[model samples]
Target chain A: MALRNASLSVNKGEILAIIGPSGAGKTTLLRLVNLLIQPTSGLILFNDVNTSGDDKHQRSLRRQMSLVLQYPALFDTTVFNNVALGLKIRGCPETVIKEKVDNMLAVVGLSGFEKRMVKTLSGGEAQRIALARALVTEPKLLLLDEPTSNLDPKNVSIIEDIVRAANTKSQVTVVLATHNLNQAKRLAQRVAFILDGEIVEEGASKEIFEQPKDERTATYVDGRMIY
Target chain B: MIYLGGWEEIGFGLFRALQLIFSGDPEVLRITLISLRVSGTATLLGAAIGIPVGASIALRRFPARTLLISVINTLMGLPPVVVGLFLYLMLSNFGPMGFLRLLYTPEAMVLAQLVLVAPITAGVTLSAVSNVDARLKEMAVSLGADPLQEVRIILREARLGLLTAVIVGFGSAISEVGAIMMVGGNLLGYTRALTTAIVLLTNQGAFTEAIALGIILLGLAFAINILLTYLQLRTKAGLFAAETERHHPVT
Candidate 1:
């Protein structure tokens, strides 16, 4: 996925929404920023430091960020175990893990779902559990790839509230990728329009949707056919 | 002993088979126990070695991986008699490492069956672990799991498939005849197992006794499969009452 001239900067403690149509490289951008995949040409900077490191270096950097995919790739286990896996890997104490997992589950409005098997959960419940797992780790940067795309309105609202709460309460930086223009407008402080693997326009959320400097951005924001 | 008409022979044999099973004939009991010990040991040993090896092979991406998998798959259908012959030569007095004189022993029988079962378990496990969703590993790595932890999670997700691998191995071990017969020599009250005993009884025209042993073998297979299936589903469904109650006490 060729990403060119996509030079984008995200300030700390703010939601930067990348809005684009399907196959427009939104997931790729998030993965690149998360450092899960290497960019062939561009440099990725996390916290103003060049992230050109070996595998060990990358893993340490990755521990500070969490990526929630469009579909929740939850493990086939109990909800508590799924939410507790990241902490367990970090070698957190059992008491601490239980405390944090419980808090996160409650945060996602899934209190007492600890023993419930993940296989028996509904889509919304599972996504909420996914959010719980991702947010439970308290990552410095939360990368969401269309988190609410497949969710019902109720789940969508709940998830949006959770993300907003995480940013507001923990001061977590967020890079959200979504195809829903309205969702981008609602959740993001800043919005960047991407098309064909290139960033067409970027500005404050209010400004970009209203007066996109690029023709493609304007066309997409107006819900028109853009080639 | 005299040969009888076909339908009446089958009828008499079946009646006597049931009689032997219910009456617990000493010879039948001894043969059944020997069969169980030999096959059970082989299956256990096979599972112990095969599961981890198979899981590790499935996770790796070495150059010889495809070739190794192909070899294992081919070995799954390895002829039992061939294994018996190979082991027979190896354990024979003139062959290398034959000084221990393990030929025609129950241990030799187990060795033969293990050869037959290990490949089956390993091949099935390889297929099972490979069939698990690839996204699971990505998720594990994303969540800070090192490579080892990634494998652990994959194995956990493929637990049912791994169990099936073991069950299939056990099935193979229990039903085998040619290899054990060749190496074990079908020694009465010694290495003679259900299949070998059935063969002996049939050859001697004790058809009813052979049929009895056949029914008992089928019964053993049925019982073991039912037990394993119960464990798999029960654990999966969280219905292990004792464990469940301890972990999740009623509120």
Candidate 2:
């Protein structure tokens, strides 16, 4: 029971941040949104349609979204191949794949790195590649689970900028689960604070951070709540 | 004087073996070619059958998986002579499979090697695939890969182990004399292989010829294994270098 009674909705083309103390089921919420795990008691509606379908339908729904984890988990291959994998999975043409991958790499500031092997990449570069790989497919939805927690300040700023641009320019809805409160306020317009597998506070970032309706949310927002 | 003479015989045999190999002595070449054909075919078939079974058993969860893996590991250490004797019985004139009449043929030798190699290849592949990071699968699925595509990624990641399995299988198939000798009949210019020929030469008291053939057999397996090992090491060196740099970054 990683998550319990967690009801959340992600508005399309908007960034929704899930902020909470550790073990508040941020990852479970993201996994549920990604359809990686089915909820036992609740229904997920994507585009006004229930996502409880057969395997093919489930796969189809999943393909429309992408998830980036705290750990990049890039393939043991060239950067080009790693970024090109999603486009390749969609069965895009070779020219289209090459063009898309190259453009995505450039967007992530890793231009001309097509021939570089992934194992040689630094932690930041690998995460950027992971982010590039996720965003390359132009997925309708992007679920990021603590995507920048392990990153240094420089890489974190680079990643946040990239995510913001992707959300604004591509109209890709973003659901970000993060332990960083400032990051949630910086990037997300609307934030949901989950505590103990439940969303205790859900509102605009300003309201949650300044005038939280719940005492727990205020303590958590004040950074005094210890796990 | 006798010990000195023994050393001279071994030195001369080594020299003669090199000459036979370099000059392509017709008999030596024939035996070598026959051995390669039998072992090569058997290893090819073994890789085809073993890699899939090994990879499937590693990635997928089902009932009796541990038992199946145990059975495969046990099969890997089966003695070549015992396998030969069993195969000889099965392919004999009055045996159940005797209707095919594959006895005493090169095909029979191939079948024997196939049996010995398949389990070895499968077992190695199973171990290798199981060692791949479990996070990779979840990453693949998160990137929109379906089950089949996810499997493709896993197989790609485990490519090195698969290569090792084939090389090991080929080594076993080419070196084993018992199974091929019994099933191939060790006929002159037809079924005769390096090991069988070496045995025949030694029995006929042709010590120099036997020694020469033995040296060539050992040299051939060593040369092929070295080549594959060099390729493996080259790739591994790159990975190790990168991993070391990641762990111990220079100031």
Candidate 3:
């Protein structure tokens, strides 16, 4: 499939979910958005500014968006330090850093885990800390790569709630990639069904879940196990 | 030419050797001290140049990296005799560096060891830096750390391996003889070290004294190895504990 021909826009404060089988390029799409891997050919506009020329410009654009990997890539450091890292990079003042980290951690329901080591955290707890790490940067957009995959059902619900709340409270655009249809319906306003490196269908989450456009989307939403 | 084969004779010879060492025989004492000093200097100088060079290579991409690494690997295996002869030629009166008059001096011995050890140090340090977790670099860059900041992080994570590199370099320098003997002239009470002295005593039929010096050199090498092993183990344990204590299950 043509990699860069696909186009999808995430509006400010809108939660867009992309659901697909494994090897459908869902993670590749997120990686493209994160600029970790550039598309062979495509237009990626952040704030209507094309960031394809200089790597520095692309990095600057990246600062405006945070991508949370499926496995929370926390540092081998304390939770507080991990959450404070982005601010530290931006050279934020000490007092401001402390305040923002505390607020962010609290929002992610990890208020007292500041000094805790990353290795001791459970999968869900680590994911929450990862969320706080991303949110502390105050990015305009947050892209998640199956953030709830390793989480328990309870943690999954909590993560869904937190994503919804983040979109509402902070007006941050949320783009979640998952294979779980129920989560797509619960947390996303719009859903895009991808298959074989192509977006098969794109529409409102409710309509897409109830009335999938393509056979692949229908099979995927119907839980026929496309993967 | 001579035959004095007896247990009593052997005992007497060993006793005389010990007496020579303890009574502060200037020649023996001077050689031991010079060896240590030269080896120490070379190791330190090697570290000063090697670690940073290795770190830079590991962190950045440049043309000729493969060629550079191949050259370093080849240098790591360089023959001490060849190095000694090459330096001897370069520092002779007819050569450009002859005005410095460095040959047959402790400094010359040190310079030779530096050449021999620098490549080993750099190669080991490069491996250390390369083995550092890539996730750490990605994490640092993702946080907008500049190249310097990223390298600092790499160095911090690679401290133990760098220390090992220094220890190994020192071990290699201390045991080398050809370079020291050639450049140091193995001069009496001057630039002689354990290896050169052992060679000198053997050449002069001082078998008992040479054996004694050989024993001491072996002891020194063993001690250095033990100390370095302890240091390596301690650093690894410390890292393990630190990682566990601050363990973020992420990348």
- Give per-model TM-scores: 0.90, 0.92, 0.80
CA shift of A133, model 1, Å: 0.9
Clashes of each: 0, 0, 5
Best by DockQ: 1
Write the residue-wise lDDT of candidate 1 on A1-227 in tens digits.
66888899999999999999898899889878777778888789898778778766777777788989888998877898889878776767778888999999999999999999998999999999988899998999999999999989999999999999999999999999999888898899999998889998899999899988888888889999555
Docking class of 2: incorrect
Candidate 1 C-alpha RMSD relative to the actual structure: 4.6
TM-score of chain B of each: 0.90, 0.89, 0.84
Candidate 1: where are CA atoms >4 Å away?
A48-52, B1-24, B237-251
Candidate 1, overall lDDT? 0.86
| Candidate 3 reference-contact recovery | 0.16
What interface RMSD does each of the candidate structures achieve?
Answer: 10.4, 14.5, 9.8
List CA RMSD, all candidates.
4.6, 6.1, 5.6
In terms of docking quality, how is candidate 3 classified?
incorrect
lDDT of 2 by residue, B1-251 (tens): 35785677688789889999889899899998998899889999999999999999999999999999999999999898999899899999988889999998999999999999999999999998998888788777776677777787787777788789989998999988988999989998889999999889888988788889989989888988898888776664232123211111111
* Top candidate (TM-score): 2
Q: What is the lDDT of residue A190 in candidate 2?
A: 91
The DockQ figures for the candidates are 0.33, 0.23, 0.18
The lDDT per prediction is 0.86, 0.87, 0.82
